[model samples]
Target: MTTQQLIDQIKIKKSFLTIGLDVDLEKIPHHLLTLEDPIFEFNKAIIDATHDLAVSYKPNTAFYEAYGIKGWMSLQKTIQYINLNYPEIFTIADAKRGDIGNTSSMYAKAFFEDLNFDSLTVAPYMGKDSVEPFLRFNNKHTIMLALTSNEGAFDFQTLNVSSASGSKELYKQVVETSQTWENSENLMYVVGATKAEYFAEIRKIIPDSFLLVPGVGTQGGSLSEVCKQGMNANVGLLINSSRAIIYASNGTDFAQKARIEALKMQQEMEEIMNLRFNV
Candidate 1:
């Protein structure tokens, strides 16, 4: 999906919530295991229950990769179901992949072409060459990691670096340098909501670029703070709540419980949009 189309969905739904389909077999309802493909069945129930409350659904690739071929097949079915049933909803392959240029291209093709995800998470540690290949895909967003929510982020992302103009943090360098690459407009970013204060500075660098924000709910990130610090004219934020929503309950009513959590976030987002943008 194009950036405009994503923004349009946010407006239509009065929400910019992205539900993370980071399914864990151990945490899912026990009854689902009786199904042939438990992972996909769990995902289908969650998607069916909460699709309207969210604008996007991100399935972290690690969850599928852990189960090997069957896991991958389940993931394929999940994405296919989303594309076929709710084409308007954005899909993200939360595969934080980055490698050499050629390898990166193949990864891009896997997610963008074969799986047909609208976006994919990419690590930027290997620099431009590792990320540019993913950006080259038209209408597909490459969400580069920036200031993350993890405590380890302080180990490097916040390190000061000297530049000709002055001194800036390493995360700032990544954000600024990425804009100079090919098909940079297709670039979005991953800015963890735990670092809500950083969003103000981040916006000064790339005010219009969309940010796929994780670390809400379970991570104790404040929704209101993130919205106040990160929201732009387009409401440029996709706040994700994974464990707190998807694992709300592990019983037969899991899907309904998931919807309740999702609905809470959606209601919060709607209130923020109404107050901030008068939408």
Candidate 2:
């Protein structure tokens, strides 16, 4: 989907909430285990329950990759279901993939060409060559990892770096330098919601670009803090919640429970967007 289309969807739904589909077989209810594809079954129910309230769905590849071919098959079915049933909803492959030139091309194809995801998360540590390949695709987005929510991110992303150009923090340099690779029209970014305070500085660098922010619900990142600092004229944020919404209930009412959790977030987002957009 184009950026405008995404904005339209968010407006239509009154939400920028992106539900993360990180399905874990072990944790899902025992009743669902009877289904041939329990993962997709659970996803279908969750999507069915929450589709009206959410504008995006992000599938983290690790959960599927762990089970080998079967898990992959579940992913394909789930993605297909989303495209067929809810084409308007933006889909993101949260693969965090970054590799050399040729390899990155194949990675791009695997998500954008083959699976038809609207966006894919990429690590920029390998530099432009690793990211430029993904940018070549038309209408598809390459979401670079800027400030992450992981505990280990402070190990490197927070370090002060004195480059050939000048002195800057590692994450800031990554955000500023990566903008030169491609146009913001096709590039979004992964800025963890936990880094809400830094959004003001990050937005100054790339004001118009959308940010795929994680760590909202489960990670204790305040939504109001992010909206206050991160929102632009267009409300440029996709705050994701995986465990908090998806695993809200383990019983048969799990899907309904998920919807309840998602609706709560959407309601808060709607209030924020209405006031932000009106003024």
Which digits, one per residue and each the tens of the lDDT, describe model 1 over residues 182-213?
99999999999998999999999999999999
Output the lDDT of residue 216, model 1. 94
Off by over 4 Å in 1: none
Q: Give me the candidate number with maximum lDDT.
A: 1
lDDT per model, in order?
Answer: 0.94, 0.92
Model 2 backbone overlap count: 0
Q: Could you give candidate 2's per-residue lDDT for residues 183-272 as a string of tens digits?
A: 545789889888789899899988988999999977879999999999988788999999999999999999999999999999999999
Model 1 clash pairs are none
- Give per-model CA RMSD: 0.8, 1.0
Model 1: weakest 10-residue lDDT segment is: 161-170
- Give the local distance difference test score of model 2: 0.92
lDDT of 1: 0.94
Where does model 2 exceed 4 Å of error? none
